[model samples]
Target chain A: MIKVQQEDFDVSAELAALAAGNHGIGGIVSFVGLVRDLVGPDNAEPALRAMTLEHYPAMTEKKLGDIEAQANARWPLEASLIIHRYGRLEPGAQIVLVACAAAHRQDAFDSCNFLMDWLKTEAPFWKLEETEAGEDWVDSRASDDAAAARWQAKPDRAAE
Target chain B: MKILYFAWLRQRIGVAAEEFDLPADVTTIDDLVGYLTAKGPGYAKGFAEPQVIRAAVNYEYVPFDHKLSNNDEVAFFPPVTGG
Candidate 1:
């Protein structure tokens, strides 16, 4: 499942739903990304007051669905979920969530990481960080591109 | 054809969306971008750095050489920063 919403979500509730009736699922891995207070040069001080997220309505959902589909094809997962929030969010607010359930721990863990790595680089959302200094559009990090690239170095499903 | 701009591009272009008849010569995304940049100051400024500007056709990301159709929805924006 994949969702893009303006409202916050309950992480625990989402996890419960993913593993609801899946008795075959023996392990689950999840990741939550939060809006941090730190910003500016060194990212050592608390400068960000809020972050306004913008996305193309239908396009956002389409891209997220594609990412989820790719993850499912690459892993032996019983279930997976992705929830991302938009609009003006304050510091420490939940920004995104990824959860995966599988019969083994490896698939759950690896797929969770894969989902997040692709989401960071491929999702069609933009962020404007509001701070005392001024609002600034966040830039795509090279590190993120690097992380996403590793997955492409090999075929879709290769035994690790 | 429909053209959409987002985030800073929308702010700079002063409009979110617009419709135009695709000229016969505008066969690809790069061609369409060149046409937009030649339209007016707003477009020129918004696409000042065309290399950094990204595009999508029918809601899917595409390369500059991606072919264009008469009724396609094309969007222009900066690199994605979402998680």
Candidate 2:
């Protein structure tokens, strides 16, 4: 499953739904991303007041579906779920969620990580952080590209 | 063809979307960027750093060298920061 919405979601409820009747699944791994109240250097005070997420509606869904599909193709997963939020969100608000289930713990864990890594670099959403200083569009981090790069290096493993 | 801009690119360019006739010689994303850059200062500033600007052809991410065709919806924006 995949969703891009402005409303917040209940992670527990979502997880329950994903594993409800799946008797074969033995493990589930999940990740949740949250907005931070602070920005800039770590020592800097909390300056981030809110963040606004913008996306190409049709394109966002399409790209997310592609990422989810890749995860399924790469793992022996029973189920997967992705929920990302948009619009103006305050600090500490939930921004995204990713969950995966499989017959073993390894597949669930690995696939969840893979899904997040790809989504960070490939998803179409853009974020604008608002602070006391001013609003600024967030830049893509080189670290994210590096993380996504590791996946490309081992295509054979990913296919297995 | 339709061109769309997002985030700071949209704000800088001063428009969300626009319709343009793809010139016969504009065969790729690079060619389209060159044509738009010649339009005015707004476009020039928005695309000041072509390296940081990303393009999507018909909603799929593509490089500047990607081919173009009539009636395609092309979008240009900064690198993605979503999770």
Candidate 3:
């Protein structure tokens, strides 16, 4: 499942839904993102008042589907879910959730990590931090690009 | 053609999306950036740093060298910052 919504979600309910009846899944790994009250490098600058997520409606969904497809192509996944929230949200509010289920812990763990890494660089969603100093669009980090780049070598190494 | 902007580009361009009558000379995403830069400083500023800017055609990521069609849906945005 891939969702881009303004409303908050129930993580437990969503995870359970992912693993509903199929007993073949041995494990599930998940990651949830949250808005922070402090923003910037080292998360030490600007006190965040709120966060507003902006995204291209149709394009966001299309890109997410592509990301999910890539994960499935790379791993033996039983199920996966990605939920990203938009609109105004307070600090500490849930912003995104990613869960992956597979027949083993390694696949579930690695695929879950790969899903988040790709989403960080490929997803169309953008974060606008509203702080007492004023609102600013969050800048992209090189660290994220590097994180996603690691997977580029994985397929080649696996084949070798 | 429908052209869209997001993140800081949208903020600087002062519009989320717009219909544009693309010129024949503007054949690719790179050319389109030049055309938009000529619109005004707001657009110029938005596209000033070509390296950090990203483009999509019909909702798929593409290079600046990717060719454009008159009816294509084009979008320019900054590097994504979402997780």
Candidate with top TM-score is 2
lDDT of 2 by residue, A9-67 (tens): 99999999999998999989999999987756675754888999999887899999999
Across B1-83, the per-residue lDDT of candidate 2 in tens digits comes to 99999999999999999997899889999999999999899999999999999999988999889999987999999999998
Assess each prediction's global lDDT (C-alpha) against the native. Answer: 0.91, 0.92, 0.90
lDDT of 3 by residue, A66-129 (tens): 9999888888899999999999999899999999999988888888899999999999988998
Chain A TM-score values, per prediction? 0.93, 0.93, 0.93
TM-score of chain B of 1: 0.94
DockQ of each model against the real complex?
Answer: 0.89, 0.88, 0.87
TM-score pick, better of 2 and 3 = 2
Q: By summed lDDT, which 10 consecutive residues of candidate 2 chain B come out lowest? A: B62-71
Q: Can you give the lDDT of residue A5 in candidate 1?
A: 90
Per-prediction TM-score? 0.95, 0.95, 0.95
Off by over 4 Å in 1: A39-46, A155-157
Candidate 3, which segments miss by more than 4 Å at Cα? A39-44, A156-160
lDDT of 1 at B83: 80
Number of the top-ranking candidate, with lDDT as the measure: 2
Q: Measured by TM-score, how close is model 1 to the native structure?
A: 0.95
**Which digits, one per residue and each the tens of the lDDT, describe model 1 over residues A12-129?**
8899988998899998999999997876678766588899999998898898899999888999899999999999999999999999999989889989999999998888899999
